[model samples]
Target: MYLCSTMKKYVDVILPLPLNGTYTYAVPDDLSLSVEAGCRVVVPFGKKKYYTAIISNVHYCPPSEYEVKELFAVLDDSPVLLPLQYRFWQWLSGYYLCPLGDVYKAAMLRG
Candidate 1:
């Protein structure tokens, strides 16, 4: 069982867009168990399309700038991202001076 805490868990997701940052989504109690760093999830972005995003970070710290959006669905039963892979993505993002989202799309894209 989860201990009671004032701070709630939040997830930072990487979208396929070329944007430089990740979006924060609040994890509801029902979906908390299933969400993890490195899994792909479906989230409603903006007013329209729902995009599949890579779960890059999971933490208790909620973002201060904007209200977090709720996740629409989880696409993976298990984490598709390995811890090492996650680390590499971070390094790649910094080294290449490109958004992690772009690297993620390249890595996940299958022909």
Candidate 2:
């Protein structure tokens, strides 16, 4: 038998776009159980197109800028990123002198 986890918190995510930084989203009551740092979520970016973004951090404070949007869906049952992975990406960005989005694009293109 299988069981689903419960969600009880909200999170603010940082998308790798030119936009400012961090968008807030509410965790579904039932799905929050598996949500955590490094989890990837499919979210509506602008008008069309959904992008897979890593959950940078989770918080309870309400967004102070724009209205928070609900997450379109969770993509993984567990977090996809680890601390080392994040650090590596950071290092790559610094060494390459490029935005993280460039690295993400390269990875996606290869796939």
Candidate 3:
């Protein structure tokens, strides 16, 4: 039998602001079991602000350029945005020449 080993997990998230690309954050051990793609998470973005962002991808590759930040909180027990919906949003962002955050903003609009 093969033994399973735990690896470092990272999440790429789409912030609600008008941004171009996803941001990566490190998953703390306490939140690792529950954090996943499409889940909303609270992350500290700028020096003085924290934003609620949507997780777009989860993987083990750590970014080589910058120091990854730790996620503050997980907002959902399950995925809020489905995989299919994420692809559609990606298409919309590309076709419309807008930021993914813009697509996310319009899609998540509340009345």
- Candidate 3 structure quality by residue, lDDT tens digits, 19-84: 999988989989999998989999999897998899999888878778889999999999999999
Deviation of model 2 at 86, angstroms = 0.6
> What shift in Å separates residue 37 of candidate 2 from its native position after superposition?
1.2
TM-score (C-alpha, index-matched) for candidate 1: 0.86
Best-first order by TM-score: 3, 1, 2
| Cα lDDT of model 1 by residue, 7-111, tens digit | 677788999888888898888878888898889999989898899998888887777777678898888888999999989988999999999889888888765
Give each prediction's root-mean-square deviation over alpha carbons.
4.0, 7.3, 4.8
| Residue 15 displacement in candidate 2 (angstroms) | 3.8
* Model 1 pairs in collision: none
Ranking of models by lDDT: 3, 1, 2
Where model 2 places Cα greater than 4 Å from the true spot, the runs are 1-8, 14-22, 108-111
Locate the minimum summed-lDDT window of 10 residues in model 1. Answer: 1-10
Residue 84 lDDT in candidate 1: 100
User: Which model scores highest in lDDT?
Assistant: 3
User: Between prediction 1 and prediction 2, which has the larger TM-score?
Assistant: 1
Who is ahead in lDDT, 1 or 2? 1
